[model samples]
Target: MDADRVNTHTDARSETIRSATLELAQELGFAKLSIEAVAARAGVGKHTIYRRWPSKGALFLDAVLSSHETILEYPDTGDIVADLREQILAAVELLARPPLDGLFRSLLGEAQQDAAISAALNERFIAPQTQRTIDRLEKARDAGQLSPDLDLELAMSILSGPIYFQFLITAQPLTHDYIDRLLAALFAGLGPRP
Candidate 1:
């Protein structure tokens, strides 16, 4: 086969493997997810998964991050409120979807006891989003939309904290209207004060 056809074939197979990993992880949780199970689910040989990812943790990280990227689109509209609203809405939607939601919940649950899993989850999934939020906040501050004294890292946490709290702790159903109202409240506090 030609190189283009070979590349396309590999890409399709990789996506299928990742999808199967998510499905299996959703049902089996991270600790119980095995290469053999994913291979069976994807209808591919176990060597395919092993060739792509050396270990279960690496495969799970790829699957979780791939699912996250497919679902969440962090906005960079230059207007902090618009960007934040977009980000929060995407996250809320992600939490409501059963497949992605189960993947994340499983990762978080396993991260508590497994250091490798915790590192992978934080590095691959959480840190990048937080970094993007920081970059956006810095731009807003530079544009004079935010106070220069603002701490971007803390600001990122503050911006994302409520949605996560509602999702994980309160178990509240996230609606568009709810996110709008929540953003209003958060922006009010983050806004310039006399």
Candidate 2:
């Protein structure tokens, strides 16, 4: 096969595998999801999956993250607040829905016990998303929408921390109102000056 044909074939197989993984994960939940099942569903051999991913966790990570790749991206609409709100709302909506919510929770649980999974999750998903948010914040700061001295990393954390806390720790509903309140507080600051 020519290089182009080979690349196309490879991409098709990868997409098939990722789709099967997601379907199986949604049906069986991540705890019961296995590479064997995914291979069978994808009509590919177990070796095919193993060749691409070292472990089930790695494959699961890729499948889940890839499924929501576009939603995870930050928008640049000039109005940083509106752009951030749109992106955050999309993220929260994903987390609030079926399959992704359960899948993400399972991934987080697995990451806590597996160092490889933890590192991969941070490196592949968390770090990149965090950097994207920081890059947007930097633009806002440069444009004078955000305070020039504001630590972008901290700002990113500040924006995400409450959402994660509600999602993972408190199990509260991640409503649009909740996000509005969070953003309001973030931009408004707290208390009277001393």
Candidate with the greatest TM-score versus the true structure: 2
The runs of at least 3 residues in candidate 1 whose Cα sits more than 4 Å from the true structure, single-residue gaps closed, are: 1-13, 26-33, 45-58, 68-73, 190-194
Candidate 1 C-alpha lDDT tens digits along 1-194: 12221121237898899888888887887768899999999999998777777567667777666656755555777788888788777776665556566566665666677676667656666787888778888888999988688877697678777777777778777788888888777766755777
* TM value for model 1: 0.76
* Positional deviation of residue 4's Cα in model 1 after best superposition, in angstroms: 25
- RMSD per model, one decimal: 5.8, 4.5
Candidate 2 per-residue lDDT, tens place, 38-58, comes to: 999999999988777777887
TM for every model, in the order presented, reads 0.76, 0.90
Q: Model 2 off-target regions past 4 Å?
A: 1-10
